[model samples]
Target: MPRGAVRVDLNISLDGYATTTDQTPENPFGHDWGRLVGAYTATRTFRARVLGDTSGAGTTGVDEAYAEAYFEEVGAEIMGAGMFGLHDHGDDPDWRGWWGENPPFHVPVFVLTHTPHPTLEMEGGTTFRFVDTDIEHALELAHEAAGGKDVRIGGGPTTVRQFLAAGLVDRLHVAIAPILLGRGIRLWDDLRGLEAGYDVVAETADSGTIHLTFRRE
Candidate 1:
């Protein structure tokens, strides 16, 4: 039997916006706001486990702690096509991969997309597989590839909403930033009237973000 779990990890403004209205290349976020995600992505454990690099060590105590807690058990990842850039118009057919030279997810990554694309093999052990079926199909594929380890649901709000609304997500990790974007993508927008509920499993706050974990009840 394949052992895996799905969890959402994202940073959002206090007013609830993952990215600003103009989600173009010029302004990824609105108004140069919020803390840089680089710091969170630079953790030693995060680098080693996700990026397949040997460098990096515990810098900030909190950062190191969160890295250890979140990344220790991940074996696979599932993401939305928007997060993987499948909807982006580009000449290169292989332009869907998230990280350029080296992506952070070293394990199998199942990307949810409407169009069927070939599987992408990147440096290290990461392979981005496009799933044109549905969120449940992607989860099943992720679980099959994960062996006995956990499967992380890398999000773009819409994808997370699909899973949450279906009651398929087992866990969620939300990092609420202190800044506010006023308008953009929202985490709870699509899940407004869902009959699902999440029980708080853990909560923590830092200078830039507040981390919260939830388990379906």
Candidate 2:
């Protein structure tokens, strides 16, 4: 038993795009994907532990339960450089992360990047360590950081595709929103040659989102 379990939690459109065309400020995605993520992150227990806030009092049952499962079982996090944004460059060497002063992840976060950068120590015991190596190296570091817990693969599509192509991901949890993004970024772009099989372990629907969990089979 390693320190962590690799899991990917992401939101996609009905068309399978994780992001819409023109992600810039001028042409933001028309869908309310941010709202959906906000709702998911606002779970009472999740917010309390991750954000150090107790304002998320009225979270629904399913959302709270899902958040608990994600956060409680996670010991470390892995993400692509894109998901972490362009913090690697620019003048701010110690930019920490995009999650402002305190990121949601309270454990070690292994960021996959090409350039080498120093580890960022944020509030709430979150350390953002950049990894320029391949997926296998990143997974090994994440598992080491997890310390017998599970490693979560936070994504920006490309990173998830790499892991999937390498046959490294054990489980995937995708929240499908009821919208269509003509084109932007897709999750299954490079999965054509992989021998991955999935079993639908659970499925649920909310106001505007359908949650689907798959276990590698």
Candidate 3:
């Protein structure tokens, strides 16, 4: 069978920031993070995965539809070390991750970092393998472990920008929140005229978040 799609999903601010500068140990996602991902967090899928809430207490409309699409056919995930809490927990050898014992991703998750760490096996099928390799090599490893399913590039802006620059991403879905972060990691920085290569489509959810999908043409 052919290899699966390489996808990237991110929640960015109106000003194109994927994160804010106010991130700290206590506030891992920072001040604007919550607002940026409010639509997604209010979805049933996120509540189920992150909060372990199967009581079905989230929105079931447009936002939830996109949230459901995020987990469909994903067999592997690649993320930046910052997303895995390596920037904060780099020195701590016992720091598992931001997610407790059972992470949402039940597939092999490759964490890109400069300092390689041992493979961490969590409660679920989520195994975090720290790698110091380049993007191509990391994708190769992830593809091999995907078992013919789609590979997701779970990001922190910089990592997603790297893959975007390398022309490695096949599809990208971004949820643009109405907030303006002013100064954080900008997703569109140095990516001038980047949309020319993709067949783009946009939709607005009832919660006011704009969903944009880009598929390489």
Candidate 4:
């Protein structure tokens, strides 16, 4: 079988910003975070997988289709320290993550951080492994843990940008929310003409969010 592909799923604003500076100690995610991923989190797939809501209470349209694809065929995940809630909770050694006891990822999760922490095996099949190394080494470990399934480059924007800059990503999916967040980390800052080698597709969801998918040629 072919080695699983490297993928990234992210939510950005109309201006291409992926992060905001308004995040306070009280609200780690900041105020505009929800607006960015509102359409995505409202999908049935997200409700069932992330929110653990099985009552079938969410949209099942274009956005849902991408949301469903996000979880499918992913065997291992790689995320930044902030994505794992490390930037804010680093002081707390027992702080598992933002997802509580059982995270949504039911696979090996490689967290890119500077510190060396013990492997945290969570409730589901998910196990958190911190990699205090380069991106290539992290990808190697993730691919090994994936066991032939796809390796996901889970985001915090900066992490995703690194993979994209290194040209290691196979498939890139971004849900473009309509909200205008004037101040934040822009996703397309220096990565101009990134759509050159990829087959791109754009679809507007019922919720006005545009889903853009880029598959390497």
**Each candidate structure's count of clashing pairs:** 1, 5, 0, 0
Decreasing TM-score order of the candidates: 3, 4, 2, 1
lDDT of 3 by residue, 93-162 (tens): 9999997899889999999999869999998899999999999999999998998899999998999999
Candidate 4 stretches with Cα past 4 Å from truth are 24-30
Model 2 has an lDDT value of 0.75
Q: Give candidate 2 misplaced runs (Cα > 4 Å).
A: 1-3, 21-31, 35-56, 87-91, 193-196
lDDT of 4 by residue, 77-108 (tens): 99999989899889888888887788888999
lDDT of 3 at 56: 86
Winner by TM-score:
3
lDDT (tens digit, per residue) of candidate 2 on 84-153? 8754443567565667767878889998887777888888778989888989988998898888888988
lDDT of 1 at 94: 51
Q: Can you give the lDDT of residue 23 in candidate 4?
A: 81
Q: In model 4, what is the error at residue 29, expressed in angstroms?
A: 4.3
Pairs that collide, model 2: 3-148, 3-149, 4-149, 5-150, 5-151
- State the weakest 10-residue window (summed lDDT) of model 2: 27-36
